[model samples]
Target chain A: MSRHARDDNVPLNADATSSRDLALEVENLRTVFHTEHEQIHAVDGISFNIRRGETVGLVGESGSGKSVTARSILGLIESPGEIDPASAIRFEGDNITEYTESEYESIRGDGIAMVFQDPLSTLNPVYTVGNQIKEALSLHQDLRGTAATERAIELLEEVGIPDAARRVTEYPHQFSGGMRQRAVIAMALACAPEVLICDEPTTALDVTIQAQIIDLLMDIQAERDLSILFITHDMGVIAEVADRVNVMYAGEIVESAPVEPLFAEPKHPYTRGLLRSIPSTQTSGDRLETIKGEVPTPNEPASSCRFAPRCPKSFEECSEVAPIPTAVGDDPDHDAACLLYPESMTTDEAVAHHRPADDGGEQ
Target chain B: MGRWEYFLKRVLLMVPIVFLGTTVTFLILRVGPIDPAAAIIGPSGDTEAYAAIRDSLGLDQPLWIQYAEFMRDLLTLQLGESWVVVRGQSVWELVGVYGPRTLWLGFWSILIPIFVGLPLGFYAGLNPNTLADYIASFGGIVWRAMPNFWLAVIFVSVLTQSDALFGFSWGDWLVETQIVTPPDLSGLWEPTQFLGALKAILPAALVLGSASMGNEMRIGRTAVLETKNANYVEMAKAKGVPGRLVVWKHMFRNALIPLVPVITGEAFLLLGGSVLVETVFAINGLGYLFFQATINGDVPLVGSLMFLFILLSVGINILQDFLYTVIDPRVGYDGGA
Candidate 1:
C-alpha cells in the first residue's frame, strides 16, 4: 500500500459532530468462537458508543469482526461463539450484556433491531412481507390483527416500496433484491427502535440501490432519532452515512475519528491504506492501491501489532510490541492504534520528527 | 397466478406419466410368454377352443389396436372381467369391493407414522443429542429393521394367544383395555366394536407403518435440525419472537417442507408392503387378491390390479408435488412451461 500524506488544510465537516444522549454503549467486547482446537478471537476488546441520532460506522474488510460485533450486541451469538464476561453492552443506561435469553428477546428488534446484508435470508420466504413485518409489530409494539397489518403496510410505504398495500401481500421471493432489502428495513424499523445495527445491509445491492438504501436509512434515522451502528467493508459507504468511523483490523479498532478527519487525515497506516484503496475518479488511471496481506484469524492473543506484517510504514518496534488505541491529532475524538502515536499523537511536526529517513514516503 | 397455474400444469402432467406407466405394463403383458388364450381355454380344451378364445377376445388383433383399447378401458374405468381368481367377475366390481379394506389398512398405516413417527422425531429434534433423542432414534431403527411379513406373523400369533392369568386372548385384552365406558364383563360380550375392528387390523397396520414411521422419525429430526439453523429462523428469533412461536410459526412449516415428499412417498412403499402384510394377516384385501391372481395366471385380474396400483402411485406422486408447492411457495411445478 502506498503511503497517503494527510491533507493538512481541509476544514472539519461540522455535520459529523453531535454531543447527544448515549443510546448504545459497547465496552471491552471480546467475542471468541471456539473450534475443537482453537478459539477464533473474532472481536477483540473493541469499544464504541453511538449517541442518539448519530450513525457510528464500524468499517472493516471481511473477517475483521464487524458482523461479530453487531451479533454480540444483539445477544444473537449462537453455540461455539463466546463473548468474554467483561464485555458490557449498555443501551439507554441498562447494561443488557448480562441479560438472559428471554430478556434479550424482549430487547432485540424492540429496543435494538438489525438489518442483515442479505435481505432474502433476513425475511422468511414462507410468509408474506406484511405478515413478517406484522410479526415484529405484534411482538414488540403490541399491534395486532388489522392494526398490525395496517402498520406493516405503512412501514412498507415509509421504506419506499411502491404500492405498499399490494406489495405487502407478496412473498420475499416475489420482490426484487432491492425491494426485499426495503422490506427488511421496514421490519427493523417496525417498532421504532432506538438503536439499529445495520450489518452490511447494502453490500448485496447494485451501486444505485446501495445509495438509495443508505439515503433511506439516513432519512429514517433523522425522523426517528435512531442511533445506528452501521457496519460495512465499504469506506465509501462509511463516508456517506457515518458520523464517527471506527476502522477495525484483526478484531481491533485501529482508528476512530469523525468521518471527515478519518478520510482526509487517517493516522493509522491501516486506515490510510483503506482510504487510499477506495475507487476514486482522481485515481481512475492508476492501479488501485491494496493492503497486501489478509487479516489474520487471531487464533492466538495479539503478541505484537497484527497489521505490522502488511503495514508499509511498520518499523522494528511494530513487530515487537502491540499498539493500543491512543489519541491522534488535535481532535479529541480521533484515536489511532499505532506505536507512532506512543502517547496521544499531537501534530504533523512530531510525526515527521519521529519518522526515520529511509522509510518516510515522498511527503 | 403462479400457484393455480402450477397446480393445473402438474395435474395435466399426470396424464402422460400415468399413460406411459400403463403402456409399459401393456407392452410387457402382451410380449410375455404367458398366453391369456391358453390360460382361458385350460388343459382340457381342444386347439380349436384356444383359437376361438383368442379370436373372440381380440387377442389376434394387432398390438396397437389392443393398446388403444387398453388405454380407452383405463380412461373409462371399464376394466374387463376377471379370468380365474374370481372367474367372470368384473375387475372393477372386484376392486370396488376389495379396495376399501386395503385403503382402511393404508389409512391406519399412514396415520400411525404421521402421528407416531413425526412427533417422536420432532421431540427428538427439539432436544437433539439428549437421551430422549437417542432412545427415539434407536427405537425407530429397531422397528424399521423388522420385516413387515415377520412382524405381522409374530403380532397375529402373539395377539391371538390366551393370557392364562387373565383367561383372555391378547387381542381381547387390548379391546377390553380401551378407554370405553363398558359393562364390567364387556370383554366377553361387545368390548367396543371399534377396538375389536382395530384389533384385527392394528397388527398389520403397525407392521406396515413401522418402516415408514422409523423413516419419518429420522427425517423429521433432520428436517427440524436443518431448518432451525436456516437464516429465516434466525431472523424470526432476532425479531424477539417467543421461542414457542418461533418453533410453531416459523420452524414447523419450513421443517415440514422437507418431510412432505418423504411422507407422500410413503404411499408407494405401503403398496408393496400391503401384499406381504395381507398374506400374513389372512386379510382378503386387494393385495391378497393380487397375489392370488398373479399366482393363478388370472391375466385380466392381474392387469387391472397392476394398472390400479400404477394409478394410485401416480396419484400419490402428484399429491407430493402439490404439497411441495403448498408448503414452499418458491418450489413451483414449472414443468412443460
Candidate 2:
C-alpha cells in the first residue's frame, strides 16, 4: 500500500481538481419510503459533508439510515422511496437533489461512484469482471474497444488481482469473495469518480481481507486525492479509515467529531454506550456493556430525543425536549446532541468542566 | 462433468423416458376395450370372420408376446401398417405425409408468441402497476381463458365463411390471391405448397398462438419482475449504466434464464393444441391423423405418434437443461457426480 502511494502523483483529471475543495455537501436530507401501511423515514434530516481528499465515516447500527443516506446522495432511491423536496444534495457546488433520471446518469459514474456490500451479489454473475469494468469506463469515459480493455486490465491489476490479463476473462463466480470485492472496487474506480461512496465495502470480507481492502482504499485515496464517504456499522473500521466520524441513531446524526477526539471523548450517551460496548484488551474476559433498549422504529413520530429511551443518562427533560447540537470541550468542531452541555458554555467553561480530559487520560 | 459430457448424460437419460412412454402407450391402447379386429370385421354377425381377422392380425397372441413383438418392431423402426384407419398405409408413411404440416403449425404458434408476447411482457414488467401493465395482464387472462377449439371455431366461422356475420372475410381474400391454395396432398412437401398451406392455416395459427401467448406473456412478466429486484440489477444501476442498457442487457438477460424451461415446454404445448386447430382448418397434420386413428382404433398409427410426441418432449427438455448452464454462469454441471 505504501509502495503504490508514492508512485502515482499525477492528478486523476482536470475537472476533479478544478472543482471547489468541498466534494459533497448534503444538507437536511430526508428519505422516506411510503409503503401500503405507513411511511418509513429512512433518513431524517441528516446533514454532512465530505471535503476533497478527506475520508468521512458514517457509523450506525443496522436500520439507522446510514445506507439510506449514501443512496440518497447518489440519487439511487426510486419510487415508493423519495427524497423530500426540502432536501439538498450539492455535489461540488451544484444542487442535484432534483436532477432527472437522465441527468443523474451523466453524473453517476463520472462524478460519483459507489462500492456496495456483498460483492458477489453486486456483480452480474454472467459477465466477466474485466467486461464489467470496461462497461463502466465506456459509459463514463467514452473509452471503447481495446483502449477500454487495456484500462480495465490496469484497474484489475491496481486492485491487486494477480495475473489480471488472464483473470479479466473469468466470470465473477470464478473469483473468491475478496477478489470479487476488489473487482467491484476496480469497477467503481474505473471512471475516476471525484467522490466514492463505500457502503460497508468490507462487511462481507474476512477480517484479514477487510484490513487489506481498507489499506488499499487508503493508499488509493492518498494517490488520487479521492473524497470517500465510508459507511459502516463497525466503529473499529471507522477508526481505521475515517479522519472524521459521524455517529447516527434512529435516522439522525447524534454526534460528529474528529476520529481521535470522538473516540477519546464521546459526549452523547448513545455514543458513550457504543464505545463502552467495544471489547478492549484491558477488559478481556469481562462482560461487554450494552445499551438498554433497541433502536426505535423510524416510522414512529419522535416527540423528543430519539435515543432517550435507551440512554442511561436520561433525565426528566431528555424525554420532553429534543437536544440540539452543542459544542463539547474546547474543540468547537466537536459537537454532540445532548442536554448535558449548557447553552452558554464557552470554551473556558467547557474546559473547566473537563469531562473529556478525564476520559482522554484513560485512553 | 464437462459440458459435452453433461450433454451426453442428458441425452442418455432421454432414452429411458422415451422407452417408458412407449411401453405405457402400447399397454394402454392394447388393454383398453377398443378391439381393432372387431372394428375391422364390423357388426355383420360373422364370428368366424372376426376370429380369423383377429388371429391374422396377431391379436390372438398373449399380452407379453404381443408386447415383445411391438418392442421389436419399434427397435427396427418398422411401425406396422395402419389397420381399420387409413388401412394398408404404414404408420411411418402416414407420419411422413402429415408430420411437416403439424411442425409448420407448431413453429408459427411458438414463434408468434415469442415475438409479440415476450416484448409486451417485458414492457409490462418494466412498468408494473401502470395502465399498460394492467391492460397486458387483463388481455393475457382473457386470451388464456378462451379455449383453443372454441377460438378456432369462432375464427373459422367469422373469418373464413363466405357469408360471414361480419360480411367481409380475410379468408376469401387469401384464397383469391393464391396466397392460400387449397390443401394439395401431393405437393405438400414442396416449398410453394408449404407457403400456400401456411397462408391458409394463418387464422388457425393465430388462434392457437394467442392462447399460448397469454401463458408466455405471464411467465415472462413474472420473471422480469422478479429479476428487476435482483442485487446485480441494482448494482448495475449504481455503476451508472444508462437505464436502457440496465433494463435490456442486465435485467432482460437474467430474466430470460428462468424463462428457458417455459419456452421449451411450449413446443409440446403447441403440438397438443394443433389437434383441434388442424381439425378445424381441415389440414392433413399429425394431430388430425392421431385423432382419426384413435376414433378408428388404428393401434399402430396411434402408438407410433404417441411415441414420437414423447421423444420430442424429452428432447426439448434436454435442450432446455443445456441452455440453463449457458444462461447462468453460477450454475455448473462440472461438479456433479
Candidate 3:
C-alpha cells in the first residue's frame, strides 16, 4: 500500500479530521453512467464520513443514487458506469478511489462488506447456508475445513438463527425471509469488516420481521462496534437505528444532521416534505403532504438547485443558482444545501422566509 | 413419491413411448406402397418366387396378425431376420456388429461438444456484448447453418484429396502414420479392435460433433449469460469471493442446470448427424447399416433400427429428467403431483 500524497485542490470540511475515529470518508464521489447520448450522474459529488462504530443513515427514494453510492465505495461499478477521476474515497485515511480491482478485493470483505436487499435472491438457492458463510470465512480468513464450518455455525448462532447446528445445512429456500437475511448478514460479518453497508436490508421483510432484523443489527453493532452505513428509503427505520442522517434527493445529499435535529428541524424543503409525508398517529384522517412534481432525471444538468422545481418554498434565487452546503442553525455540524440556509442567515430567519403568508408565523 | 419410485415411474413411462413409436413406424413401413417382395425380387419377372418369399416371411398374414406378430417379436427380443440385405442374418446380430461403432462415435460426438464448446461458451459469456462475444456468437450461427452432410463432404475433400486444386492428404496421413488404424469392422466386439475402430470413426465424430457443438455452444452461452444476471451471482461477488471462484463455483453449476435438456436433445441430434457422416466417411456404423437396409428394403433390419433409435431417444429423455432432480433441488418428485 503506497501512501500517495493527497491532492491539495480538493476542499476539506471541518468533519474531515485526521482523527483515527473516522472509519471511512467519501469526498466529492461522483458516479456517472455514460450511455450513447448522455451521461447520467448517479451519485453526483456526494460527500460524507462515517466515524468508527457509528451508524450513519443515507435515506432516499429509489434512483436517488443511494445504492450506487454504496456500490461505488466497494469499487463495484464497472464499464458504462464509472467513478470519476476527481472523486476520492478514503478508508481509514488511505485514499482508495484509485485502487485497482485486485487492491479492492483485499479491502472489500476484509475491511468493508455489504448486505443488499432481497435476501431470498441474495442467497444462492443451490448451496447450503453454512457453505455460503464458509466461503466468506475461507476467502478472507485462514480458517478452513472443520474450523471454517464450526465458525460458520457460530456466526449463524450469533445472528439469532434457531437450531444453528441443524439449520446451517438447510438451503436458502428452507429458511424464512428474515432468516435468509440474517444468513446474509452473518456472511458479511465473517471477516469482521470495519464498515458494513446495509442497502435496505429490511425493506423486503414483513413489519414484525423488519423490526427483528433491525434489532438484530443494532445488537450486532453494539457488540462489534461496527461502523454501519445504513441505506434506506424509510425514515422511521433510520430514526430507530441511525445516529446521523443524510437526506438524499436527485443524486446528491440535500441535508445532513444529527438524527434528532434533522427530524425536528429539517432545513431542506425536500427533507421537510419527506418527514411530513409520513402518516403519523397524530395526523389521522388528513391527507398526507407530498412533495409536488417528480424527481428530475439525473441526466439533466443542475444549473440551479436540483430540488427547486419540487420544493414548496422555492424563491426566485432558488432557480438562478445551485446551493452549496452551508452550516445550518447553531450546530455547525448540521449542514444543508438550500438557499434558505445561506451562511449569512440565522435558522429562525431562514424558516421565517420560507413560511408561506397563509401559515401563522408561529416560529 | 420416493426418489427411486419416481425414477422407476419415469423409466416405466418410456415403455409406452417406445411401443407407440415403434408401432407407428411399423405400420407406416408395412402399409406403405413399397413392396418388400417386389423390391427383393427386382423387375426381372419372378412372380412365383416373390409369392414364395412373401409366404415364407409371413408378409401374406393379415394386417392385425402381422402387427400381433411384430409386437410378439418385440416382446421376445426376436426382431426377425434381414430379408433382402444379408438374407439370413438376424437383426440382433447386425446390431451387435454395428452398435459399438455407433456408440463409440456417439460418445465422441457428445464429448467433443462438452469439452470444446462449453469452455468457449463460458469464455464468450463472461464478457458479453464485447468483440469476442460477437465473433463467437456469429461463428456459432454460421457453424449451425452449415448442413452436416455438406460439412462432411467438405471435410473429406479437404482431408483426403491427393490431387488437383488445394490438395491435402490428412486422411492418408492418419492411416499411414498409424495415428488412426483402419478399423477391423468384422471384429469390433474385441476391446483392441473396438479401440482401433474408435480411431477410424474420429473423422466422422468430429464432423457430427461440430454440427451439434454449434447448438450446444449457443445453449451454453445463453445459460451462462442468464446465470450471470442472477441475484445470487451478484451476491457472491459482494461477499468478496474471488472472480474466478464466483464464476466457477456459483455461476457455472447454475448455468449447467438449464443446459441438461439441451445436452440430451443434442445426443439424439448427433445420432441423426451420424447417418450423414457415416455414409460420407464410409464408417461401418448403424447409421450406414440403416441406410443400406433402407436401400435394400430389408424390413426387419429397418424396423429394428428404427425401434432402437426410438428407444434411445426415450432413454435419453428419461435420463435428462432424472438429472434435473439431481442438479437442482428446487425440482423434485416428492409431491407426487
Candidate 4:
C-alpha cells in the first residue's frame, strides 16, 4: 500500500539501466475544477511517469495546467474543484486517490512532497524560523526539544542558509528571497519523501540564484535517489535536468518523448513552436518569437484540438473535432496529439489527398 | 521652528474642521423648533416670568449675538450651567457626576473584546474552510449585524427570564434607577477604581464589548487568512511544521500588525459612544449630562461637550498613527504620510 516501499522479489531498474526504476505512474489522470460559472477541465486525462532518481519535466507555457497536473498528483487540489474519477495516480503500486483520509496522513508529506513558487510569501511572518522548521520535522517524524532544534538547524544548513545556528531563530522576513526558497526546499526535504514535486522553484529568483537552486535540487536528488516531478515552463531548465519531457498545451499533453528525441525531432507543430520560442543568447532582439496565440482559458472549452487554433498547421478538421494522442512514427513512448497524423485525421484531409502542410509555409 | 511650524499647520487646519462639525450639531439642535423659553417657563407661567427666564438665559438675544457668545465661552472652557436639572448645575459638574461611569464602561467593553475576539479569530483563520472557520465567520457576522441596543435589550431579557426560571434574584445591572453623585478622588489608586467603577461601567462594557468583540473577531480572522497565504507559511509547511506553530509563529504576527490601528480606532469609537450605552443602562454618565443639556437647550454646555468628543477622536487618531508606525514600521509617524 506504500508508494516507496521496495519489493525484494521484483528486479529494480525495470527500464533503462541508467534510470533507476519507475517511481510514480500517473495514468489518464483528469482533474476538473467546478467554478461558480463553469466546469474547468484543468488536467484533461494527462499521463506520465517519473523514474526513480530521475527528473521528469512537465514543460509548458503558463496556464497549460502544468502546475495543476503536479498538484493533482499530490491530492492538493482544493475541493469543489472536481478531479475526474477516471484519473489514477499510482505512487509505486498503491493508488493515491484510493487512499482513505487516515492513509493519506502518512503519505502527504512522507511519501511525496511539494515545493511551491514565490519564496517571498511562502513562510508565515509571525513565527520564528527555528519553530517553523522544528514543527515540520515533528509533523512527519518524531523529534522533540533539543533533537528537533538540532535537526532544524541542520536542515537550514543543508539548504545553504548561512549562520544556520543563529539564522534558524530568525524570522522569514529577515531572510533574502534566495534564502527563503532554500528554506522552503529544506522543509520539503524534511522527511525525505520518495518523490518531490517542484513547481517553478527558480522562476522567481535571479539568474544566479536560479542556477544555484537548480544545482542544489540536482545534487539533493542524486544524494537521496529521489524521483522528482519537476514542473517548469522554461525549456532551458528542461534541457538541464529532465530525462523525459512532456510538452503540454491547453491542459493536454501535445507531445511526450525522451528529452533528446523530443528536442531534436519535436514532431508536433506546437512542440516545434515551443522549441523555437526558447530564447538563446544568439537570438537576441526585443522580439522573442513566441508561440503565437495565447493558451486558452479553462472557462472556454476549445472547439476541436485545444492547440489547433494556435497551431500554424491547423486545418478544417482541427476546428471541428479534437485530436487524440497517437504514436509519432512508431516510437512507443513518443506521442503527438495532432490532426496531421493519418490515424487521427479528419475526412476533409483524406479526400484532399493532403498531408499536413509539410513545409513551414511562409506566415 | 520646523517641527513646531508643522504642528501649528495641522492644529490650525483642525480648528475649522472641528468648528464646522460643532456648528452643524448646534444648528440642528436649535432648529428642532421646540422653543427653549416656552419649555423652560411652562405654558401656565405668566409672560413676564418666561420673559425674565429668557433674558437670564440669553435666549432673548439675537441669533448672531447668541452664537458669538457661545463660541467665546467654548474657547475659554466656561461651558456654563445645565438648564434641565430642577436647580440647574454647571455642565462640567454634571459631567463630573456621570463621566466615570461611561469611561469605566468603555474601558471594560474594549478590553473583553480584545481578550476574547482575537484568539477566536486567529484559530478560525488557521483552520480555513473547516467547521471552526465557518462557525467563527457566521457567528461574527450575526453578532456584528445586531445593533448594540438590541443586544443589550436581549441580554437583559434573557438574564431576567433565566433568573425567574431559577427563582434567583437577577440584579438590575443594566437600568440603575438610583443615581449616585461622584465622590472626591485625589488618591492615585482611587482614580483607577473610579475609572473602573462597576455600577456605571459594567452595562456600558457589556453593550460596547459585545459589539466590538464580533467586529474584532472578523477583522482578526481576515488578517490571519491573508497572512496564512503568504510564502513563509508554505515555507513553514514544507519544513513539516505542525499546524499550531505555523499559525501562531508565522501567520499570527504579520496578521496582527495591520490590525493594531483598527483595534485602537474601534476602542476610541466605543469610548465616544459609551455615553449612549450609559444612558440606556440608566447610568448618569457624561452621555446623560450631554442629553440633559441638549434637552434643556443649554447650547454652551452642548457645544463644550461636543468639543471634548472632537478632541478625543483627534487624539485617538494621532495615537493610532504613532502606534501603527511602531507596530509595522512601514507607516510613518507623521500622520501616516
- Comparing chain B with the reference, what is the TM-score for each candidate? 0.89, 0.88, 0.87, 0.76
Ranking by TM-score: 3, 1, 2, 4
On TM-score, the stronger of 2 and 3 is: 3
Better of 1 and 4 by TM-score: 1
Write candidate 3's Cα lDDT for B1-337 as tens digits. Answer: 4446666788898888888998898898899866888877888957799899799878989999999888788767788888878888898898898887678778888898888787778888888899988888888888778888888888677656544545655544434323222245567677766656566667667778886678877888998998988878877777688888889899988998988987887788545667777777766788888988888888888888888888788888888988876777566433321
What are the runs in model 4 whose C-alpha is more than 4 Å off? A1-20, A100-102, A281-287, A298-303, A329-332, A342-363, B1-100, B111-203, B228-254, B285-337
Question: Number of the top candidate by TM-score?
Answer: 3
Candidate 3: residue A9 Cα off by (Å): 18
TM-score for every candidate vs. truth?
Answer: 0.87, 0.87, 0.88, 0.69
CA error at residue B211 for candidate 1, angstroms: 2.7
Off by over 4 Å in 1: A1-20, A281-285, A343-363, B55-58, B61-68, B138-169, B176-191, B333-337
Quote the positional error of residue A286 for candidate 2 in Å: 4.6
lDDT tens readout by residue for model 4, B1-337: 2334544555566767777876776676566675677766666989888889889877777877877777677767787775555346777776676666566656678787888888888878777789988998888777778787776666556655655776653444343322223222334276454433454345446667776778788889889888766656654554444556556666776887878876787777444565555556666666777777667766556667887777677666656655554445333224310
For model 2, state the Cα shift of residue B60 in Å: 5.4
- lDDT (Cα, tens digit) per residue for candidate 2, span A1-363: 111111111122324545466788777778899999998888877776778899999998888999889888888898999998877788867789989988888888879999998887999877878889999998888899999989999999999999999988888878889999999999999978999999999999999999999999999999899999999988889988998888999887888888999988888888888887777612665677777778887895444678988878776666755555555655555777676764466533432332233334111
Best by DockQ: 2
Clashes of each: 0, 0, 0, 23
lDDT of 3: 0.81
Ten residues in sequence with the least summed lDDT for candidate 2 chain B:
B174-183
iRMS values for every prediction: 3.4, 3.2, 3.5, 5.7
